[model samples]
Target: MEEKKSKFPKWLKISLIVIFVVGLFIGWKAYQTFMGASVTDKEEYLYINSGDSYEQVFAKIKSLDIVKHPNLFDYAAKAMDYKDIKPGRYKLTPGMNNRRLIGNLRGGYQEAVKFRFENIRLKESFAGLLGKNFEADSTAFSAILNSEEIAKQYGFTKDNFFSMFIPNTYEIYWNTSPDKMMARFHDEYTKFWNAERTEKAKALDMTTQQVSILASIVKGEALHVDEMPAIAGLYINRLRKGMLLQADPTVIFANNDFEIRRVLNRHLTIDNPYNTYRYKGLPPGPIMMPSIAAIDAVLNYQHHNYIYMCAKDDFSGYHAFATNVAEHQVNARKFQKALTDRNIMK
Candidate 1:
């Protein structure tokens, strides 16, 4: 069989060769447009706000001065058809290509923030912490938290509404709405209180809210993890015996002064529901966002005869426990003398 003959016209052959070369060049350019390294070698994050237009996102990318990519993403976006950019905090790696970067945005594959809180004593502080880790600011969160309607929506009153947020590390998106954020916390709180935990709360004849309140006190008094159960037990004993809680932390909380190291007589005289020194039962709410360990400590409090706690005289975080007024007075005297020697007078 004879091979096919070339076209007779020389000009036609030359034109065909030129077209083939141009097509190859175009293909190579397209490949580099999508796959070549375009972003700058910098550790930064790109924040895409909700409801942002494509133009706004493009402008935001440019504002970062990001890329070897001054004008390339337009072509990349068109070629890859990456419209509807998802809102989030997207991490820009050291050196990323347009395809990898835009693909992540298109799929809404944003980094989940590690949200957490500890020793959070007020709604203001909690809101502030959320503001730091989310697209929503403190004001937005505070508005939601301060709303009595929102609190009721979560099955809590405004006064005790803060108990819905449990302290733990949570994985959440940065752009979650304020209401959704509350829902998420509520979900976590519910999951944390399982059947076993509910049974334990019933066994002790205490509500979960009451447990959280006592946990906050236990957390306030005990500096070391080992002492949590003992302190919890002492408080439980007081509650069972109908004695005044007289917790120094509650006195500090009633004064709304976290700076008070020594609970003076004047401080205890504050007229507040949170003042366990004046009130005969548990405080109306938790004085702080208690830790999980603290909560569990109350659930599994050590059974004992102790009903009093006085901090040790050595400026150590540890405390001395006593079962009687006389013993407590002796411990209190030693701690008071140590405080006086150290000039910690109120």
Candidate 2:
């Protein structure tokens, strides 16, 4: 026999030994690298949207070359317990290996920034806020607010811009246009209107426009939520009595700022239609976007004969309510004294 061929050929035996050793090394490395290191290729950009199934997401990762293999990425994502990722634009970088990449992508790395609109005075401010994200024309926004045609179609005259809107925190997508955002805000207001509020307005012999006007005034006056209904009641009483609302906020609104050291009898005579002190009733429109609390105060106002209120010098945001001219004058004097002491006089 030819030296009895050893049970195994030399090359075959050598190959088997090499294969086992290689397998052992790979196994140890795999065990050591749980959710292993990221790949070191060029960075890739990916836009993942919600509603993508895991397989679909895997395909996107592969197409972007953000991962070396779809199957591996999917397996790692599953192993890492990745699920239900929100869809959004993601900046994928090199070194985002199967494990690291899946973790970051599935962990929701997208950032969100909030743009708040509170106590904003004019339509221009709103347009300006929107301009920070998207190219917006403040002039156009103002024009839209003052557009007789748009206002007429929407049942809101140009004068009613502020009153027609309700102030609230709105989460808008980044980079939204001023015009489109304003339209959306109007839609939100429309959704808030109910038949009960409508009927209440009708019963009070008030139009939505008038109610919003009063609500805006109530918002400007009542720094505290509890005071809104009482303040609203005062305005309502004044309206029922055919007395001028005589609201200083209206004058300040007309003046385009609240810094008027004193509402001299002259300031109240501003020719603008927003001059409620000069007008016989509510202003032509809202002075600010009334909060829901203000709107509710108008709708479910407490029944009262009081027609005046002054801030309680405590700055607790409460007010002093008065039922007669004498009492009102007393409260007003007290508020004036408080103002003098604080040197808030302009």
Candidate 3:
């Protein structure tokens, strides 16, 4: 015979079990509602405009859909007193809880925007690029960039100030002022022109600005990096001979038209000082932003007697060097024929 078992009330046992299950469900829901993952798993970003209020920031956040539970986020924000909004680019990641997200927005913990610019041709275009990347408007950037007084304040002329910004990967704040941006550019420019580089420019009897100008032309002409030194050397030879640069790229720049693929005889007749065919020296300024390789090529140009260059007959993008104009003409005919066959006529 089994020992007699004491029986509890069925209603009481069922009540206890119900209470235990309800307690666990409540605890889990509270944890998730308060401190669980609020941000989404997908890679998303939120850009807060300057002068945005907390409500405006919230609106933008909701628009981005980076948060999983907006109601939970709102409660967390209220509890944490996250009322202040800091303007910047916020890189949202997965596994970010409400506290972390709110703290990131409130404390201005922003990710630096990595801006790697292309070989820009105009300041207007550059300003637009900055506008797209930063919190500032394009008009604001353009106003300061084009201002002569501002340029002079930074020890640069209006014409040559464009060279201050080296085309490279720059990590900068999204809310940087135009003045501060220029200051940073100047600082970078100073750092780039180290003692050795300055001495190299001095030995070449050229200022850094002049070197940049020439580098821009070299960048314009040479499609391949390896060809830069030779093209630079050829330009130096032309300069020594007091011959006009006659660079087709410069002619294209002079016409204020970047669409001209083939530099025609008519394009060379432009009276602008930037037209190297009409002008005897480097243009009033750079035709475009020069690459570091092109600038270094100018500083360390090859020593050669070759004075002329033409693109190779094929699609190699390499130029054929010639010590004499006749040889240059022969190479030019080959390239021209190739161009004609390819229907690149402008």
Candidate 4:
């Protein structure tokens, strides 16, 4: 063996030793880049906008100042051929290594936003909320929502297109398109109106939209969930008798004056289709995005002869119901006096 080793030159031996040391150093660095924690303390987010170049993505990552050893990340990114940056809202957790971070960016593994909306009364307001939660702008969303042709495609008119949006929390991607979002809503609305719910609506001699309309009135009438069924029943009784729904909330909605504390005689004269006091049946659409509880209340409304409701005089968020005009007048007088005492004269 000594004789064989003698054939090796000193330079060759030195070269081998140097190469071994360099290899060890390179291996250690690679391990640190791929396995060691790179993200700083606390969670962070990286928003790679659409059409962003790799350089732009790197700039954003650097601007966040969350990554430790950014050069190492760059090296590893290049080594893994992660040259393409996908657009998304990526969540970077603490203790995330460069490999995992790059993997997320390359794969476009975005975080879903918890988009929620309820009690949205106007189409513009609903569009604004959707814009805030998604990539679509308010203008674009509103235009699409107001398009008669688009509404007809979904089996709705522009005025009633808002009924398709069942108010609830939705896990939505940040970059969902407007049309895609509407389609999802359509699917959700269909799923919500199942065979059982459809049969219930038919039993009550109401369409799905009609039920939603009544639910909206009930929602606007009372804030207390426990009283929703009673309110719904009162409206149903009124509907059955061919009497005016006379829902005060509908008058307020028709006047477009949400600030009105009292629906005075002046507000009632407004010629709007939403005015249930004037219109013989349900409005063209829901006055507001009715809650699921309100919708269910309409479906399971308590059978009663009550055709009238007035806000209670005690300031509790409950209503006084009556079957006769005389009893309703007494309840209304009490409420009017309370309103007068508070100086809520308009």
Q: What is the TM-score of each candidate against the true structure?
A: 0.91, 0.66, 0.89, 0.90
Put down candidate 1 lDDT per residue, 212-237, tens digits, no spaces: 88999899888899999999999999
- Estimate the lDDT of model 1: 0.89
Sequence-dependent TM-score of model 2 = 0.66
Top candidate by TM-score: 1
Error of 3 at 330 (Å): 2.5
lDDT ranking, best first: 1, 4, 3, 2
2 or 4, greater by TM-score: 4
Q: Kindly give the number of clashing pairs for every candidate.
A: 0, 2, 0, 0
Candidate lDDT (C-alpha), each: 0.89, 0.73, 0.86, 0.87
The parts of candidate 3 lying over 4 Å away from their true place are 1-26, 41-43
Candidate 2: global Cα-lDDT? 0.73
Q: Which segments of candidate 4 are over 4 A away from where they belong? A: 1-25, 41-43
Give one digit per residue, the lDDT tens place, for model 4 in 29-65. 8889998889886446777677889888777777778
Runs with alpha carbons beyond 4 Å of true place in candidate 2: 1-116, 134-143, 175-183
Q: Which consecutive 10 residues in model 3 have the weakest lDDT in total?
A: 37-46
Can you write out model 3's per-residue Cα lDDT over 253-335, one digit (the tens) per residue? Answer: 88988998777898988799899888898887788888899999999999999988888988788989999989999999999
- Listing every candidate in turn, what is its Cα RMSD in Å to the true structure after a full C-alpha superposition? 3.8, 7.7, 3.2, 3.4
